[model samples]
Target: MSEATPPADAGNTVSVAVSALDLGALLCSRVCHDVISPVGAIVNGIEVLEDEGAADMREVALDLIAKSARQASARLQFTRLAFGAAGSAGARLDLGDAEQVVRQVLEDDRTKIEWSLPRELLPKNRVKLLLNLVLLAGTTIPRGGVIRVAGVGEGDGMGFVLTSTGTNARIPAGIEALAGGAVPQGGLDAHSVQPFYAGMLARDCGLPLRFALDGDTATLTAA
Candidate 1:
């Protein structure tokens, strides 16, 4: 796997020719894609209830609708912290909020998150980087796993770590290359762009991302 740490453009520059609005739109598209299935299920359930005459079928449809709505809401909550502009200008985010959002995202997945940030607040940029790293690590454990996120040290000496372990754990192919500043021949789209985005966020936050993967375990450290 290729490993490189390139600096993101200073002053929040866009790496590509595309405008910032376009990039935001792309991220929004990704979020929409994720919630569409659950939202669609809810819509279908409502339609079924409206059309069906059988009370038992209507009850089942109601259950399906309730579950789907919860899933959609959770995804939206996660997206707000992970992708949306969450904090005010020059403000730190509450770690509790971050944990809550992370937990919500994990609710639907087989994976579990073990968060241990000793600090009560963190710079918004750091929180964004952390969430994105969690998102990246979440994709590695295909067969369910544990994601342990913790803060190490205190004050200026602080750093964050995310350790993912499970059966068949593996980083997605070409992600390391993307972090190393190599674009795939086919280019990146919504489905395969997150790892690259996380790398960029790390750079933007002036943090270095280091990863060590062996067998069914992967550890991501940022400082």
Candidate 2:
């Protein structure tokens, strides 16, 4: 049998086609990456407790286990809502709950969240989009900073603005292109799936998303 010739554009087509399975795998990887450290720390703490010679460090081990457990729980809760299928289709989510989860995952000694969203219900996807944006804003200042979240309007007209401020803060690399639905030059992976997913959520919510950099601050707006 003779071999058939391949289409000239086949390579280009395959390059940009990210299958649903690929996206799901990448997103799962991202969530795992976020929670793995704390999970591992908890295991380490358990190991230390099992070591009879380390009795002198029992207090430290207990503290580590407690802190790591909280961290793991917070990340899982945040991911459950932000990236998982939270609630039923078309269900509404309370912004108050969103604030609580965001605060749990993002606030620390070096990072702070200033949430100004009113206690109102919003579409589940919209709340998910806001949570993802808050995650993106938190990353803008890896050295630790403040994230200020504010909401505007009501119901279908709702919108949000989040600002990250800290020394050396700037927009995250490749976010603009990713948010615009372009696959990264380095190909889609855990690091790039988030912004792309955020953009998809914005489109589904019928909201226009934007990112801006001003001096030492980075802002994400969906309005």
Candidate 3:
């Protein structure tokens, strides 16, 4: 947790013990949290459409419905790859697919994403780790910001960096600790469980996760 120290304890090697069912439940909760807003918008639009006296606003309601549907779909697709088995077993994930999903979710008025990774395919596990980092980084910018994702080096020595910058940007406290490999003394919940899961993935893959923060900017790296 220190600025000079790596995000994870270099010499320490312990992982939180989470049951399969518990992990599944937590992940599902995350997915629901992401999709609910857009889904609610869609329902509200339908209700507006059903109001005969709201004829003057029908076009606006339709536009709202369309936008919300797209947002909901984008979230579901990203979640599938990030939390579910998106591709075949033991195969490299398609970078195009990953980029599409990310851009759909992150490239909006509030945030912009720049993908600097190689165009070549990447191992599925690595892609998952990268996407989860994006998800974590996106939450840092409350007002508006830029998230730059880059893949560097090669093979087991490969490194991934995610940098976020904006007004009032900051990583959430409990999530940052969990993502950096410190298990909370209390049990994980829907909000704090994601970083713990992501950290475990990095550790099991023999990657070291680190974080550097300065003022309103933060960088997360795994190498």
Candidate 4:
């Protein structure tokens, strides 16, 4: 991944060259890609439960169902805020709530989050941008690691920095361009839409976004 420079004027909207319909479709595809696995497990677990011959594995089936259900719920909740119209226009969202949802969605043995943002209210889009950045940072440490997030300021002047640390951690290919509002050579798809959307959110909030990689740490800054 390359470094992304902040826009000359933060107030200006970054041009994302994609149709609204295509953006929406790609985002939906991304969400489905995320939740499909656990959802499929849920279906499989139900099938097992409904099978009389599988009575001996009832405990296993139930455990699978419960775990899958929680995973599905967590993913949905995170996406609902990070990618959906979380509230009516001009609504405000609490950072505390954002932290909860992010913690839930990222709950797993391989990864950990250390969020240090205060429990303050911010415009819904800003909070969404923060969550999206967290999601993007999580991908850098695929081998499992820690994502440490901190607030840069407060209120309208707020920004964020997320640093992912793990063995062989790296910035995802093409993320710099995508998050800088440039269409990647491969074009926009479910896999690439997320960073693009994050870029859009950063611009919409008048916060320029940048990415850097140092050794085993990948840092994403939006300020």
Local distance difference test, each candidate: 0.74, 0.85, 0.80, 0.87
* lDDT (10s digit) by residue, model 3, range 133-191: 88888877888799998886875456688889998877665555677666555666777
- lDDT (0-100) at residue 32 of candidate 3? 95
What does candidate 2's lDDT look like per residue over 1-223, in tens digits? 1211232322322226678899899999999999999999999999999999999999999999999999999999999999998889988888999999998988989999998888888889999999999988987898988999998687756999998999888766567667767775568888879988998899898888887777778888899
Ten-residue stretch with the least lDDT total in model 2:
1-10
Between prediction 3 and prediction 4, the one with superior lDDT is 4
- Judging by lDDT, tell me the better candidate of 1 and 3: 3
Of candidate 4, the 10-residue stretch with the lowest lDDT total is 5-14
What TM-score does structure 1 among the candidates reach? 0.85
Candidate 1 off by > 4 Å: 1-18, 155-157
Positional deviation of residue 157's Cα in model 2 after best superposition, in angstroms: 2.4
Summarize candidate 1's per-residue lDDT along 1-223 as a digit string, tens digits: 3332232422222334435775677788889988999999999898888885666788889999999998899889878777778868677777788888888777446788888886477777777778888887887787889999988665534568888999987766655555544444555567656666677777776677787777788778887
RMSD of every prediction: 5.0, 8.7, 3.7, 4.6
lDDT of 4: 0.87
Top lDDT model: 4
Error of 1 at 79 (Å): 0.7
Query: Candidate 4's residue-wise lDDT over 1-223, tens digit each?
Result: 4553443433333345798999999999999998999999999999999999999999999999999999999999999999999889999999999999998988579999898999989999999999999989988898989999999988867999999999998777667767878875456878879989999999999999888888888899999
Instruction: Give the least accurate 10-residue stretch of model 3, judged by summed lDDT.
Output: 4-13
Q: Which candidate leads the pack in TM-score?
A: 4
Each prediction's TM-score versus the true structure: 0.85, 0.89, 0.87, 0.91
